[model samples]
Target chain A: MPRLDWEIYEMIERNPFFKHIGFELVNSSEEEILLKLSIKTDLLNTNKTLHGGVHASMLDTVQSIALRSLYQCPVTAMNLDVHYFAPANTGHLFARAKLLQKGYKMAVLEAEIIDENTTLIAKGTGTYKIVRNA
Target chain B: MKLPVTRSTFFEYLGFNSTKTDTFHLDLPLQAILLQDDGTVHPGVFSTMLDISMGATASLETNSFATTIHLNVSFFDLSPKENYHAKTNIVNIEGKVITAEGIVYGQDGAVAAKAIGMFKASPIKQ
Candidate 1:
């Protein structure tokens, strides 16, 4: 298991929304970050499947985490595009993210969510602005 | 017009409230649990609100259930830890597919984010 940077780990641990959603940090490396969430009743939509918001949230977080792994400054999401391929109704879901481009002030990343069966549930691409302290 | 749709537990968990008058609107109280490290409401909150509001609007208009196929969100401004409002309108409908657009307003009434969603409509089982 690669050790996560103390600062990044603390940020994730202190985030209240992450706790509210029960997100677990599976692992992290310089190249990527992985997050896990167990499907619960509270995570489902009216159709009894994983809510699109959950997928979006997980994808966004994982991608941001990947950026955090590479930069010390804070990052904010500028845009997120998500496509749902299948519905996940049971078991655990895993999200993996990788940085695709790192520019002077902006970064682009891609993330995907898969079920325990390795089924592609959803995928997203996000652009984030790296906030530099003056 | 009331939408014949069942509320999702995830929606309730986010503390989002919905109303339909001239259009579909969703309101969210920026709770402590929704804030990020920068004291700004997480973008996911806005995305979720838009997705739900737009999907609900599509479903209500089509008289069926709509599932999200694609959602694209552009964040124009970071929202403070304050109340937020979202309104959605159907852009077009073609057979089983519906396209909708939504805008989220921050406490200061500034446009926080804009979203376009495509959903697949399915017949409501009687």
Candidate 2:
């Protein structure tokens, strides 16, 4: 796709684990990016349903990556807040991550995970502490 | 037909009101939600789920009561924007701290996210 960026695409494409996770860079700009995942049973929980921990880990990852896209520094997730509405039970999910705001020592980012039906699965905000090696 | 109450049946001993029809149960196959323009899920949701699993796993080995002091999650990539599954199993059970690991799988059965967290348990306070 013309909208896809080579840098991130190459990074994800190269990672063995990333490839197994079934996520690839769909598109990217300077401080924003999109990720996609295919839904399946292995991701489900003992309840014979999808688990919430899955979403939490993901939002944290994208938010950090969204920041790394511009600034090359070690940013760690200091705090995370997530909210779930309904359930993300089927199909692929589409996520859009953008730089909500940035500070001198930390940054705030937001993410949304939507199912194939465009239903909202979960939403979250995170604060990443910027470290040295900048 | 009989009382199903027991020391281990917390969910049931507590008298959870889940109808038999409510068979839907699930966990996060990823770390957190994606916050792209299209939409995304939140990490807090996963944290909550992790807490639930951790609490349950801990209760199994614990004596009476327990509380979670702190939980730390090291997230690598965004949980897939697509769909996936999740599995959580207790990793270790210690004296005061209960440690557990939950792994989320993406479309390809790969680890979408790996989380190691801790929960504190104790006997019922007298």
Candidate 3:
């Protein structure tokens, strides 16, 4: 992965949903990207924990951030597998993502969602297809 | 022997709608906020829909609340319009774990995605 600076991360943080969902980029590099999100009632499920969809969404976005910083291109998710280790209902949640592998057409990335105490809340692995820059 | 919509703000934000008429089904208007740069429905949105649908199916099938343990989705197509549909059914239920499968259909009636989710059936805490 090519070295990337902060500008690309800033550009992606401008997404409305990312903002609406309250995702903060804690750190960004070519190797990995770290994001933090506040737990809000709106982001909760019926059981009062961070909703499954939100976790999946954040994983998708964070994994893409890792790939985008390197490929400088938009990516689409082909497959996503998420495992919930525990419920995220309080405090802050952090998502850390890194590229597992990349090829000519597809890239595999992995991410983990952790609580403020660094407890693993959820884990995700996804395959993204890199599109050519327009 | 039916459950309510199981209110959730995230579902409302995504414009998710559920119905009960012999079978449970889900529908959502492809909102702009849920679209990727290429204008297709984001896979995360699909995941959320699948999660909700499967949860609803588990609730209806087992008549209890469920917490999602794991979910896996595969994308087969993409939508080019402003709407999508999802239908789910319980594939298996063994005591406390329920497994469900669902399909997402694009507006053009093509299979856009499919997902399988595992949920833990339990009583609502608090």
Candidate 4:
């Protein structure tokens, strides 16, 4: 894996949707990444809980970020599966994603979202295409 | 029965306008907020759209609200489509559990994504 660089950090910071959702990268490496999102009223659903789409989006993003950090290349998601365990309404949410496997053209990842009390909110798995060109 | 649409605040913030075009069909106008930095819409946005569309389909078929238990999606290609459409149908309903499938079509008439989900009747609502 290429050494972690500053460009990725800047890319994440500049990502419009990432900022729109307010994801704060806590730590990241080739194998795993941790992201934090402070729950806000805008991010909630009709039930006053974190939106399901937010969980799906964070998992897809964190997994892609982890793969990009590992391969030092851009990637796109090919498929994703999400299972919700609990609903999160308030407090901070954390997402942890790990690269499970990597091939020449594809990578597999698993991720989990949890609340401040460590309650599991959702779990997801995704397959991504490793883009070789820019 | 008309396909259902979500009234969630998140959907509102994303500026997604969903309408049931016909029986078990939903149409959503995509907004710029749902796009990624690279111009393609985010996978999460697709997932959310599919989830709501499929959940609504299940509810309409069963005549009650349903909670999503699991969702699986396969994406094809990303496009700068102005709007997206989804067609959902009930695969089967056995007791309290229901399985449904949906396909998302881009404005260019390409199949952008496909999804199958499992859901159960909402205990709180039903």
Candidate 5:
């Protein structure tokens, strides 16, 4: 188990969906991390614009991914609060998240969604709870 | 156009009695299955859609500028059929926070979910 626990980093690296969405590890400082993603056509919503689900999914995934790298056991989102400043059109989307505070088993994440132009399209925060599975 | 073409008909169709909604307006008989896991409509789909509806209703009530800041949702049950429907209204608005509460009825006209949200108005620099 000691060997496998140390191998989670490599296991996460092999996830196909994370690779397909082009989620990249850019930079990190303290508890904050930056993730870069490409704007793909299939990520759009029913209005031909960016789907809200995509935004939620991407934000949720990156938060969990970043947490996995730092925590002994990964956490899940309990609630999400998002604010959209403008429409996220076709272009590169960048999500940067930071750990605002971490409790014994809960943490708060503050993140922003920026486009290629560095425009802030959405701002979000979530509460995560860590639990034991095995 | 993140919404469907029938988005306009909601005003005349849903029999509006409150004149305001905190959620987005969506019509019934959606092209989604109520129960499925294989990329078919997941249970969260209804919640997401309902959240969107509530957020949209906030935009309409607050002079079309209110943005979603706090959304509280509670799920009570699931739809037995594939049909989807929702109706909402603005409950109140504080100085910076606007509150909207409404109910989402299942295809059988039973309550499936109830939600209350607070949308923060943009800060004005004066």
Candidate 6:
């Protein structure tokens, strides 16, 4: 792992929201990144299943992490599209993100959330704007 | 509208509060626990807030439980802020399917994010 990668990892580890959600970095590389979250009582929705927001949150984080792994500069999320496939009520959930397009001032990424059984729970794609420091 | 009695634990965890109005409006007080590394509010925070508020709107409109089928959100700003407010309204309802739109405002009242979502409404059991 490069020094920048370690920096990005440390940054993620220090994020308060990341800690609040109890997300763990399962794997990371320039090619892709994976994050895991264990379903807890506090993460459930009115349906007693994992909240759709959790899926969106995790997908957003994974894609942003994937982007930062490739480019160390600061980036901000510009857009996100999420599709929910099925409900997740138990066990751990995994999210994997891959960069789809890296542009001069913007980047696009896609991610999928799956259960331990590899059942797809949700899918998302995001566009982020690269900040050049105004 | 008769809302579901079951409390959404995740929504509580996010610390969102609804206004007294009949519409689906929510406010999230800025907390250190919701900030990103750069001190700006996390994008996930916006998405989660919008998702819940918008879905809640759809549910309230139909008087049934709602599940998100698809959600699209656009972020216009992510500057460090004090708090956020989100409001949602039903766009259309056809049978069991509902479409809604929501907007999130930053502390300064600027548009922070916009979202549109589709939800499947399931009749709440008596």
What's the lDDT for all of these models?
A: 0.87, 0.54, 0.82, 0.81, 0.56, 0.86
Runs with alpha carbons beyond 4 Å of true place in candidate 1: A1-3, B1-5
Instruction: Give the per-residue lDDT digits (tens) of candidate 1, residues A1-134.
Output: 13468988888877888888888998776545789999899988888888999999999988887777777768999999999999988889999987789898999988999988899999999999998882
Worst 10 residues of 1 chain B by lDDT: B1-10
Per-candidate chain B TM: 0.90, 0.55, 0.90, 0.85, 0.63, 0.89
lDDT of 4 by residue, A1-134 (tens): 44458968877866777888888998765545789999888877655667767888889988877887888888889999999889787889999887779899999989999999999999999999998976
Ranking the candidates on lDDT from highest down gives 1, 6, 3, 4, 5, 2
The TM-score of predicted model 3 comes to 0.92
- Model 5, B1-126: lDDT tens digits are 243322322122222122223235564454322222222333334445554566567655564444455454454554244565767787887786778775767677877666666666653222
Measured against the true structure, the TM-scores of the candidates, in listed sequence, are: 0.94, 0.52, 0.92, 0.90, 0.56, 0.93
Comparing candidate 1 with candidate 3, which one achieves the higher DockQ?
A: 1
Clash counts for all predictions: 0, 51, 0, 0, 8, 0
Q: State candidate 5's TM-score.
A: 0.56
Residue A132 Cα positional deviation in candidate 1, in Å, after optimal superposition: 1.2
- Model 6: docking quality category: medium
Give the per-residue lDDT of model 2 (tens digit) for B1-126. 222222222222111222111121233333222232112333433454455555555555565443544455544444344554445567777678777766545567765455566656666644
Query: Candidate 4 lDDT, tens digit per residue, B1-126?
Result: 454465777767776666664565566787666677777788987888788778777776777766777899999986668888887888999998999998999887899999999877764341
Q: Return whichever of 4 and 5 wins on lDDT.
A: 4
Colliding residue pairs in candidate 1: none
Which segments of candidate 2 are over 4 A away from where they belong? Answer: A1-7, A14-17, B1-49, B55-126
Best by lDDT: 1
| Deviation of model 4 at A32, angstroms | 3.7
Better of 2 and 6 by lDDT: 6
Best by the TM-score measure: 1
Better of 4 and 5 by DockQ: 4
Which candidate would rank higher by lDDT, 2 or 4?
Answer: 4
